[model samples]
Target chain A: MNTRYIFGIIITVVLLSVNQAFIQYWLAQKKHDANTINIAGKQRMLSQRINAEFYRLEKESASPHLLKKLVAEWKTSHFKLQSKDKSNKLVPITNSEIRLALKELNPNIEFIESQLNNIGKASLNLSLINQNQNSFLPKMDKIVKSLEKISDKKLQFIIKTEFFLFFMSLIILILEVVFIYIPIEKSLNLANAEISKKNEDLKQALTSIGKKNRELEQITYITSHDLQEPVRTINSLVNIFKIKYARDFDEEGIKMLRYLDTATVRMRDLIKDLLDYSIIGKKREKTKIDCAEILEIISKDLALKINETKAKITWGRLPKILGIEAEIRLLFQNLISNALKFQMKGHQPKIDIAAIEKKDFWLFTVSDNGIGIESKNVEKIFSIFHRIHSKDKFEGTGIGLAHCAKVVDIHGGAIWVESELGKGCTFFFTIKKDQNKIVGYEQQTELYITS
Target chain B: MNNKLNSILLVDDDEATNFIHQFVIQDHGACKHIVTKLDGQEAFDYLTTPNESGLPSPDIIFVDINMPKLDGWGFLEKYESEFGSNSSKIIVMLTTSLNKYDKERAESMNVISEFRNKPLSPEILDEIVEKYFTNKHMVQ
Candidate 1:
């Protein structure tokens, strides 16, 4: 929503991502360490059990001669202890052939201990006991070796797995830092910078526009007001010249004086038009004005020009409008005046004043039978200080139509002209219809009574 | 006859305008000595003053709207209240400005004659002069 909020969110997001990752990695490492330690403990316990069993077996199997004597004793003890399991009836000891053989082989095994004495029977007894047997000691040792080997391999595998996970977690941390956190942070900074730059640019643009607007306003004021001083001075100077030097001058001097007078008047008109142009936007003087009455008044004022041209004005119903009465009068006066001024040398000006019903506005046309404008000069006539006709042809500073344009702009209307050279011209303009005032009442009461 | 006939006063700041008015009035062979004052206050003082010699009391006043001090409208505002008998004086508005507010205000005044435009035309001149002439002759 704001710079501060964006910064706060970025910090929040970054911290959350880092902290969550840290927490996840830490938990994973803890789980791994716990499993590793548990496995190590189980391996140690297994090693201990294997060592104890191997030691006990080693102690018992240390002396072979003693082992044989113990074995014979264990056999006799085993026979007596196993009597219930196997003794349905007892056979004499000398009657069993296996025993007879064992007795022969043992003839001197117990009695003889000489260095060269014949010990074949003892050897034979040893062979019989060794039949169908594998030694427990070597097998147990091999088992222990294999178990140790397996646990060692398991420990190595677990360690490697934990190392790989540790490195993977680190890589993930690095990648998150590089790809997610760092770039997003960078982008966030860039976003803030870009917006800040744009904001600054916008502010600068607005500030300059405001400054320019004020300067333009000030220039307009100075041009309209301060510029009047020199014009008034020139007018006063002309008056003084006419009073003091008029009698002394001959016909040419008088003609020059008249020329100066016309030029000065043109200058005055120009200034007034410029002032009117500038003030149009600032002026908001609008009241309910009867448009038809204004037209009738303009008709009266332009009577002399119309008479000179021998023009006839026909009218379709002109509706009442919302405008400053004086300005609208001036607007109509200018249009009608132009029509009267631009008459063909011999032709009587036949001007028609008519209003058209438009969708959103009232479109009015003032068509003339005067010598018309060229298509190109129609636009030229509305420019400041631009005159299509020379002074000898038409009298104006070309500011009149410009002023009309400005007024129409103030009223939110479009003013355009359609003309063919040497034929006739029609000036079309649109003004918003004031829906607040009804046309029927004003027309019936006014048109009937006034005419 | 006495109520219908009275002296008229002309109050103005511009000498030329008043002179032209006097000339026009005299050209028509009306009264020779129409009382004139430089300002509204002078006219007021004259009207309310004692009926002294050379200070003929005014029956009507032609007041120019724009003046230096105590303008025509201002004079009328004070006249009706302070000197109640002065209300009988016909007060005419003479101004260049056709401001509707001024016209309405002038019409609403107690002793107002009518709101009219300046450079009073020959037609109005003859009409007003004829009425006052008969009244003047009757008084004589």
Candidate 2:
């Protein structure tokens, strides 16, 4: 959009500059034409003055010296009339009638000059001189008339040229407005309408998605609450039956009862894990949390597991970040527990936890020397109920890593793992330092709601 | 161990949960008497009305959150406003809800003494009796 405006402005400036240059050139040409016309008019006036001097010489008794002075003045005016300089280059006139008239006037000027010279040379008959001067009078009048006609024609030509230029400039301006400015404005309006429409559609989609998400959360809460009642009943009733009737039951019956007890207990644990996974960030209390403190709490919680696995856990200096204290604690707890639980046979687990500050966030890594996951199962491990090992081998409802992912996601971060089979695995995650700043998909939903 | 109280009250909408809870309490022998109410309203009625035999009020009341007529929160509101300030009866909220909001609400109310998940086991019942009832004598 900005580029379009800039391009339009550049084109308009160039066109206006070209039009101004043309107008200036035409105005200069008109000024030159006026100069030429003024010179021609001066020449005609000089011829009339010379004629008057000749009449004055004939009528009044003048001394030979005065006649010589008048003749010299006439010669000077005649020479000036046809004087040529750098700017005054004589060219043939364009109009044929004006050219022809000027041709007649030139010879007459020559004839008059010769007559004056003859009178100056001898004090001859006065009547004959006077007759020649009378003839010069008519020729001077004719030359003046022709010069006036040429000046009028030049004035008319200049006015016509200016009018034509004015009309052409107006046409160009109108064409530019019609073809360029108006179309561009119309398309801009159309594009704006389209963008607003798309924005409205996006808003509607986000609102509906938020509504569906809310409904799903409600259903999950209700389902988990209601389902636990029966499971708990089954568990209690099973326990009561074993306590009351264990002596009468056979060996096979005892094994079946124990299986029932195990199934009920596992079901209960599954339900509990599911509930925990669903409520990860439901009640977030954001504040400045010290990562070192949270890690200490997690280590204490896993003291027994750490002892059983003989895990040599080490950590670097952790930074204080703005986040939900409980969620961050849970995130560390899960990773540490997983590291302790997935150790190779006869291998003491070596777990390293550290945080490195990046440009806008902190990158945390929990690396473990454990029975590493296969490349293909790295992504699958984080999904709910995607267990890579059988329950007999590794007991889990497969919701721990999923819960960790949720915690990372709610904080506007990403979590992933880099692992090779039979070697070690490193789980990396990022947390933005600014917890109050909303980011990513959550920000979009927030905008939709507020708007 | 000697029975900790004269009577106990259980408030829950589900009969099966109440049954299991009653069995757990009976097995633990924490109280001499146990009364079961289907919902919060029934439990409230049982508490407000006087018995012809002149029995003492239950030492502990266990109420569930989600019910048809009246919920645990509604019961707590009523109980606190009416017979709350001087009564020595302990109120323990019991529910299958894993929602943090419910737990937080329970924690904020001064009348509520404990929040426990269902269905109650003998060990949990014994712990509650030992902490609230047995500790009362020690404090005195």
Residue pairs with colliding backbones in model 2 are: none
* Deviation from native of the Cα of residue A147 in model 2, angstroms: 20
Q: How well does candidate 2 match the true structure, expressed as C-alpha RMSD? A: 8.7
Q: Tell me the spans in candidate 1 whose CA falls farther than 4 Å from its real position.
A: A1-330, A352-359, A374-380, A383-403, A418-423, A433-451, B1-8, B19-29, B34-36, B48-55, B85-88, B119-124, B130-140
Please give me the DockQ of candidate 2 compared with the native complex.
0.25
RMSD of each: 19.2, 8.7
Best by DockQ: 2
lDDT of 1 by residue, B43-117 (tens): 778877776475455655778876768877778777777766335456677765434567777777767766676
True contact recovery of candidate 2: 0.35
Q: List the residue pairs that clash in candidate 1.
A: B7-B59
lDDT of each: 0.62, 0.76
